[model samples]
Target: MEEERLVTQVTPKSEDFSRWYLDLIRRTELADYAPMKGMMVIRPYGYAIWENIQRLLDERIKASGHVNAYFPLFIPEGFLRKEMEHLQGFAPEVAWVTQGGADELEERLAVRPTSEAIIGFMYSKWVKSWRDLPVLINQWANVVRWEKVTRPFLRTTEFLWQEGHTVHETYDEAQAETLRILDMYRQFVETELAIPVLYGRKTEQEKFAGALATYAIEALMSDGKALQMGTSHNLGQHFARVFNIRFEDHNQSLQYAWQTSWGVSTRLIGALVMAHGDDSGLVFPPAVAPFQVVIIPISIGNWKENTLPRAVELRSRLERVGIRVFLDDRSEYTPGWKFSEWEMRGVPLRLEIGPRDVKNNQAVAVRRDNKEKLIVSLDGVEAKIKGILDGIQASLFDKALAFQKENTCQVSSYQEFKSVIENKRGFVQAFWCGSEECEARIKEETMATIRVIPLEEEKNQKGKCIFCQKEAGTLAVFARSY
Candidate 1:
């Protein structure tokens, strides 16, 4: 906590985009690199945002019939090999433990890169018949994926997430469940985190390993690169068959259960930052902001007896109304420094009550999103603050939506696609022939991949493929992504 201020006046988000992000994270104390390579220590402020994210999403998941559960952090190696595709996909990144408590174990245990294999084993034991169908369970935990390269929340080796795994009696039920969770993810991220996302089916090249079909929500960051926000996959009895999760049907025939897996990780915190943060600092949506409002009392002589009490009162009122408010009455820091500090921390709104404000029965409010200032009367200030929080939340989503729309470009050919991808780095809309080879070629040449194939409606237009000169098969959005 005791370090030189890293955020002085360097231009953020313009020329040196990566530096801007690192500076904001370091200066504002969101996170810092840990002792282990490719891992990070999420500071308290960053953890608070994650807590809010968990709260909002957990409520939605529970309401949708999913129950919270826990599974082991390690999986038997044989379980991973049961699904060859999943094993091959995660084999390179898996960490192994061969010794336990000063004894060398006979079989090496794999750190859980994902729980599909272990959950599949449990499902086999728990689900026996249609009466036990639709076992919807979610686990909030940290996973280890030994990544070669990592960024704070984006690709850390160890990060936090909630993974939902469900089993259904029929294929149709599982498919429906997959889509239900996809829409749930879209709504949660857009409304709670203030990040608007593009929803669609993922291309085979990008779909989850071992999944019959994968759906994802893609968000455009401020720097023109795409960030994957969440993903849902229809497992289609693959894990059920492999793990022997069989059940009796209504007609007395034995059948394997249909399965689905979906998750969103701490990577979402990175998306939120890129989607809304500015040069000054983060611009958190009120819904997920640790402190929606920060109260600073601007005082002069004997002000502790005056403005401090008023500031405390206002803080109490705001707190009673369910607003996360912080009163900064520390005499060591000046009023201006407190404002900058809170601004860097991305409090949605700031309330400044000074000697004049106390005498006049008013306070000054500043918005972190736009840096707009308002002189507000103290009377009914709680209601006014509520309105301001809602406004800030909506404003952030609108601004991100507008930015995404503005950066998207529709192209008809590979030439135009390459040109646009090189000149402008946002989403490029083009028709894809639904071929893995063509998708690979395009990525090899332009370094941009299909972010998503917009949910069925965008595929209606008939045209030529952007990469291969074939009849248009599906409309897909392409971009250089993180």
Candidate 2:
């Protein structure tokens, strides 16, 4: 355990966000840069967080009637060319394999930048009748894109993610499935990750390539930058026409099937870091934290015999009730040092048990979010800890939601939009003429693009286009994003 070492200090989040993020990632042992450029290694602690995210989100995905499957990593170059739009969208980032052993391959194979082309090809073979209309399948896998700019989890050469590919008999069914997943993502991110997000459709220029329409959930990080948390694309029949995914209807008419694709990646871990972390260190929501409760036994004279046993027993009690607990009973680290270390790791609750606490049949519980301490009787410690954890999760969410609201502003003119983008740097709501020209100019001049367009009836409301001052009805959110 000496290898655990004393936790190192991180750069302040306010002083420098980029340095603070990289510093915290290393100091907290979440991830590290790999020997290869633009790649990262997910350490055990970080992987545990991802595992918890997978377990919880997988349940929701299965409940919605999607099944898991595996897909090939390499796509034949011709396969990518089947859908020119999707291929061109990923062309700049695609990695290729040109040789096998000592021999040059007859044709280059693409390390999948995305699975649309291959999955669409498979769907063509798998669907022959309307009964197989909705082929709902998902795959958890790693993907490669030769990224020029990379960050640990946010953007990398290779990363882990789950991509869901589905087929539908009708356009309405595919659109319904896409929105359903978008709302599901909203719930999962807001509830489990405790990060508030704005869910809506994207502009034409921002929608996924080959998609009729794309919807996403955008989250405002602590730094006032918007992060696209997840995306669901209504691919329509474009891929079906390209791959020949034809099915015979009950009426005996052949038709191309509509399709959809949606996914969220390990960049979510990066979201968790930015959305809720503070200058002290990481501040994790209880639902996804690796350890919800970390019990540290306070050291005193002959304390091992007196307090160590009780701390171990308390850990057993919590474990019995299915609470993730870590008992730091190491002799090498003092209680104070252990507290700082676990706090830096973002353990939600810390219970300190010393000889006095053992005698009093109580322990001191400290919260990582607010650093508030409370004395608890050991009688119903398990139930009490559960209540406190639920409160912490809710508290973190409320605090983040407040921050999002405080930073989000509604602006009527392009001047105000540019001012808000440069000064406050959060989500700015403004009307757009729904033209790529205006969207492109806004991004070029202000470095802020439309983050989302209202999904509900409000999208139909009329207003002046912030840039062109033309008759525009659609309101859009603009932000400089990661």
Kindly list the per-residue Cα lDDT of model 2 for residues 211-307, writing each as its tens digit.
9999999999999999999999999999999999999998999999999999999999999999988777898999999999999998888988888
Taking the tens digit of each residue's C-alpha lDDT, what string does model 1 give over 209-249? Answer: 88999999999999999999999999998999999999998
Point to the candidate with the largest lDDT: 2
Clashing pairs in 2: none
Q: Residue 198 in candidate 2 has what lDDT?
A: 96
Judged by lDDT against the true structure, how good is candidate 1? Answer: 0.91
Q: What TM-score number comes out for model 2?
A: 0.98
- How much is 369 displaced in model 2, in angstroms? 0.6
Q: Number of clashes in every candidate structure?
A: 0, 0
TM-scores across all candidates? Answer: 0.97, 0.98
Cα lDDT, all candidates: 0.91, 0.92
Candidate 2 residue-pair clash tally: 0
